[model samples]
Target: MRSSPVSRCRMHCYFETGSPMCGGGTRTVFSKRRAGSGVLSPVREGSTLTHGAQKGSISNYEVYLGALVGTLLGAAPAVLADNPIIQTLYSTDPAPYVWNDTVWLFTGHDEPNSDWFTMKDWRLFSSTDMVNWRDWGKMMSVETFSWASADAWAGQVIERNGKFYYYVPVTRKGSSMGIGVGVSDSITGPYKDAIGAPLVANSAIDPTVWIDDDGQAYLYWGNPNLYYIKLNEDMISYSGGINTVDLSSFQGHFEEAPWLYKRDSTYYLAYAGHCCSEDLRYSTAPGPTGPWTYRGQVMPTQGSSFTNHPGIIDYKDGSYLFYHNGALPGGGGFTRSVAVEKFEYGSDGSIPTMDMTTEGAPQIAPLDPYARVEAETIAFSSGLSTEPSSDGGGIHVTSISNGDYIKVKGVGFGDSGAASVSLRVAAANGGAKVELRLGSRTGAVIASCSVDATGGADVWKTISCPLSGSATGQQDLFFNFVGGGDQNLFKFNWWQFARK
Candidate 1:
């Protein structure tokens, strides 16, 4: 399938809506001209470029020419991404923690076709721009906790005193459910069971941990009820007894997943509220253990999932809410996907109700096209998976078939324009061609490079291809794969574009 030249030209105008070339206005239309014309006749800036413009008003030739000029002049359009940030896997119960400029996301991996929350492991991913997330792969799983038997459910990790601690709920032997703590020296960990047993067992789940300004730490978790514990300096051990907070003032049914944090001396507790199909709600207190006051719903009963988990954090001067829903294809209550939304708090430090959106969050900054971008770093992807390279290095893209593509959004090519693209690829099979498209799957093909087999899949090689079309400005790049058979085509490690 391919977009008609006329439609492509119209899209180009739409993409350039808010640029100086278009008078920093809305849509602009070019005057009509014959197809295959060498030159683009200029139309007045801010002219309305509708799809069904009257004949002789905006010619298809002018539209195409405008696109070409826009690209050559380094006026690339910004591509905004939608929700369900991770496409290659089903993620749920998002737990985001900021460590050194990047937001580290730890989520429950929902097994495909799961009928009843059959989660067995957790996944870790991180992002600085929010739009492009780098997959860190499986961080820890059921086997991580030796004493625990099954159910690697929702959890939260915190860094303290040069050590990282993860609190999660799992099924303990001879018990229904218990919360366990895992400790590691690094944030991304092969964590060890800190306390060879459940830290606090009471048929509870969904553990959220937070540390206060005065060097005190607290762990909160439970479903249908809320519990808290004061941890000692070691973090793995707690001195105080488990205390349950009074939820009589909470607006809705307080279920589980308590996210505790502090801002401006006020302590906030956000949790999944109401029954069955859960919505997010919160309460505030003057102290960590509160004489709490119910604030109200943060997110309403939306998204297809029956239950919801909340992870809230403030990063890069913006507040964000991370949750899960059955919004992906073949997703449901059991099989869910994680998503995020940028939000604002009320004037009084109270959280306002936020709705779920496909457009999750805006990019913090544009991606530099000249840098060596990992193939696994993706804003959006289709028909592909990532794995550790066999050469004992960083991650690489795999499970690629014909029509498989990876979309890197907001790539800024600069004014000079990119002359060529370089890729580190490997293929045991014959080889394949990667078509570089802009805007959409059937959008304009700017470049195509045939990757040659490097004798084996693990045998790596560098390949370069000259870009044929305009490659300037900020545009969403689509690396579309095409091959002869239905098997794997090749593996891509990293890619970058060089300026002319």
Candidate 2:
């Protein structure tokens, strides 16, 4: 039995109408189906197994061999490599696509407020898990865009009429950093600015290009206005009135930076808000042009402070949010490191849980350094420890010494490799807010930022804290020996780590 590629999110199964023993098997399942023409849809059936087990027939082990879900993408299996993970695949912004079984994203090669601000460069990274990322060095440059003397903020890659188009925003001192267009032949490219003109400058920052279901095209800018345009058959030029969506209706919403996508007959309008520092909330809407609604707050999902800046990607039979979190580190807010969580539509027809990290979604492999790891309770002695209530499996930490130093051991899969453990610590007496420190090395603090914990108890939810100390690619971790707080009790469900 073989399943047919129905759409980007599903497969049209062709089965022999009998059980496996009857010389027949099922190809197409109900959960996913072929992406037919028009708006995408929810197949709803095959998603669940005999019990309440989630996940389709897809298996992680087979992913390496390029096993596929369906044809919606021609290069299906090629994109399923989520292991030997690529740490961070995101560049300055989120670039998405629907062709192969992966989402190919483009971003910058450096960070801001750092040393590499003036020298603008680009890179290409793709992933199916949205966890690990693959970095394809320097693809474009400041020289590619017309007025881009420096600063390539928000740029989008759109494929239409058989050609690839890259749209970017640039600025040079007094001259407003406007949006410029770049053209390329391959997904990875040395794109040249198309019109030799800013895609649309004067007040616009990040520029995005979205093609509608009708095959008609539109260009969205970062001006708090949903700019619309019709693509000339080649999808190279603009044709319609630049429509404006007055987001003024919502407060704490600014900076524009938008990405538009369509799903199940509805359009999802995603954009970053709040200051460049924090208060960032990744939002969505029902149409490209909208009475946009606030789904959830973005940035700094963990501790407080501010956390804005992000990009959204839909892949792996799910929609995932990719953005840099405000991890308490030397450059926490400014680092702009990438992290991902499955973005699901909430019950009220709005965005679902934006709990910083998508807590339980099958942890996918990543594409860059600060490689992602989960929290688990693998040890227990005296003192105290935190473990997942849902699945009594993971790492276990017990207090030693003065309850200041906590030791953790792998539980579930037995040290797939020497795992580096990070403990999410909240101040014993509201000390330094709440911080995350590594327990392995004597005195290392990875992320010093803290956030809204139940507060009553010292209990904190332990997650795969990014490795910050040493170079195993773990993020926001430095072996800060976990413990403290009179009520140092916290809720730790899982621990994410990569066994080297």
TM-score of each: 0.82, 0.52
Off by over 4 Å in 1: 1-81
The true-versus-predicted C-alpha distance at residue 163 of model 2, in Å, is 1.8
- On a 0 to 1 TM-score scale, where does candidate 1 land against the true structure? 0.82
Residues 1-500, candidate 1, lDDT per residue (tens digit)?
A: 00111222223323445321212332223222222332212233344433432222211221333444445456642232356788677789999999998999999888775645677888888888888888877777878877888888898899998999988888886667888888888887878889888888888688888899999999988776788999998988899699987888775457777889998989999888765456788889999999889888898876656568888899999999999876554455566778898989888998888777656789887889899888888887766777778755767888787866788887888888899999999999765899999877678898999988888989999899999999888888889899977646898899999989
400-465 in candidate 2: lDDT tens per residue?
212322222211222232244433433223332223344332235544433334444444544344
RMSD of 2: 20.8
True-structure RMSD for candidate 1: 14.0
Candidate 1 clashes between residue pairs 3 or more apart in a chain or in different chains: 31-59, 32-58, 32-59, 33-59, 83-358
